[model samples]
Target: MMTRLVTDRLMMRRAQSTDLEGFHAVVSDFEVVRMTSSWPWPADRAYTKTRCVPINAAHGMAGPVLCKGEIVGIMGALSMYDDGPELGYMFARAHWGQGFATEMARALLDHVWAQYDWDVIKASAYDDNPASVRVLDKLGFHEVEPTIGTCKARGGDFPLRCFQLPRPPLTRV
Candidate 1:
């Protein structure tokens, strides 16, 4: 089944090869990938091609985020992680600060929680990425701790902060 999730102005679905050029355009921007943990700087079309392989597979539920028919970014969860369900999102620089990430993330979280029996969702942000932190905070995620994380693209360790949003208690039938 093709996984799809929608929000007010965003549509997230299985990423396709068609997304490579658009995806590369965003990830290649230095300012966009600077704070991202794993994205390589100068992200070429070849790199985007390689990355789309797994996203198209059935592994992580990862997909592209679209706005008005254009791929703006990617967002998804690992389905399940050691700590819990881990959610992540990335947006093109041009779309930053428009609440698209927040809107898309909220929609995805709602879908996952409703369809599964998960207790908490986890996420992380580089210390310098206040935008991401704000999105998670507005989603009701509470800060957990600060730790070191390697940004392969930057070839260095940066301070990363973790956050978690616990599922609200269920009501009796």
Candidate 2:
């Protein structure tokens, strides 16, 4: 995670307090935050300033997703369960459906494969979020299970679809 991950249209670096405004914009929207695992919906600038940065930083995986040097969203991984690292990402509503999420996830996966010896990465999405499931599917993640979980942002339990991607074989020397 030392190097910034990049794609043709996005740049990802560790999230910092300086990105408060952009972070606020993305998480404040109900549509955007509803599907998220941790963010509390109806987020305001005050909450973003007070809470978001520290929470993201603590995860050590949350990074600002930038476009042309401007923050557009956040992407990263965290181990919520004892099994392994769980891949997660969130883009501003304005940037949705342009392949940015898939791009970011792929870049993250590449980085993980190259720099870490982990066997697999896990991810989960609300079963209702077809777009997220599509992104995971496109990256070769297969469904592992289904469970119910609470989304702090939405303040209710929802059906969660879990998926995993095993590390691809490394090249021979």
Candidate 3:
């Protein structure tokens, strides 16, 4: 089943073929792509299109972050590490400085924790991207370590800050 999450100002659902154009637009921006690890620098439409295809939820959740029916960003919690699913997100440069990243991430993390059986979710940010670091921090992700990570866009290894958020304690009625 496709996962859909709704927040006060954003709605995140499975990616559709129709979203390819918007997805490409966001990834095509060098300022946005440089902060991510997977997307290459010279954004390719073909690769961006491939990303629009939805994957099985058992692997993780991913989709477009829509605001009033327009794609503004992308968010995901993919099993990129052996430890657990990793949280990742990117927003259009126009949407930067807004609270969309934190809002979407909080909703995604909440949904993942409640719907999935994972004990913890992992996340990381390039040391240079203080914006992302702040987002992860605001969401209560604890810093675990500092390591070198490769940025496909930057085309080299850079200082990476790793983080993890454990599932919140259950509350009884």
Candidate 4:
């Protein structure tokens, strides 16, 4: 499996059994989970270890983001029909505003661009998540359209702000 990445102030690596609880802490945070894309898992260890680890990935691989050694977030890509792959990320509340999300996004975008034939990398956020939109925009992604996608956290369709990028930005977050 693809593993660790080091950024300016972060160390992102593969998820581990030990990280389930910390990762779940981020999942339990309403603000973090609520502003994300698609299905959001409740804070459950069994689910996190059993169902989430094996399946919660962009392709067949994913790695969590750690700030100074704590599992503060995660990053990965989920491929779809003919649209290349979409990038996703979520960090814990205490870790916000620190550019960790942008740093991870920039790193993951670089990794994906190096290994895939993708013409684009897409991402989305709730319309109200300016921080998320700002992160994507800083990574050179632009608004495409909107979507009412499967949002397990909300238990139904939720509105999403879509953004797409042709390639990874040259800048490293």
Clashing pairs in 3: none
- Alpha carbon lDDT of residue 107, candidate 3? 89
lDDT, candidate 3, 73-120, per-residue tens: 999988755767899999999999989999999888888877777878
Q: Which digits, one per residue and each the tens of the lDDT, describe model 4 over residues 48-155?
A: 565245334446346578777778887776574476688888888898898888887777777767666677777888877789899999999989879876666666
Ranking by lDDT: 3, 1, 2, 4
Q: Which candidate is the best by lDDT?
A: 3
Clash count for each candidate, listed in order shown: 0, 0, 0, 1
TM-score for candidate 4: 0.83
C-alpha lDDT of residue 31 in model 1: 80
CA deviation > 4 Å runs, candidate 3: 171-173
For each candidate, what is the lDDT?
Answer: 0.80, 0.79, 0.90, 0.73
TM-score top scorer: 3
Tell me how many residue pairs clash in candidate 3: 0
| Pairwise lDDT winner, candidates 3 and 4 | 3
For model 2, residues 1-173, the per-residue Cα lDDT tens digits are: 44688899998876667888888888878888888877887786776776345334333355788999877878777654577788888788888899998988888778766655677888899988999999999999999979997898879999999999888888111
| Candidate 1 lDDT for residue 21 | 81
Model 2, residue 8: displacement in angstroms?
Answer: 1.0
TM-score of 3: 0.95
Clashing pairs for model 1 are: none
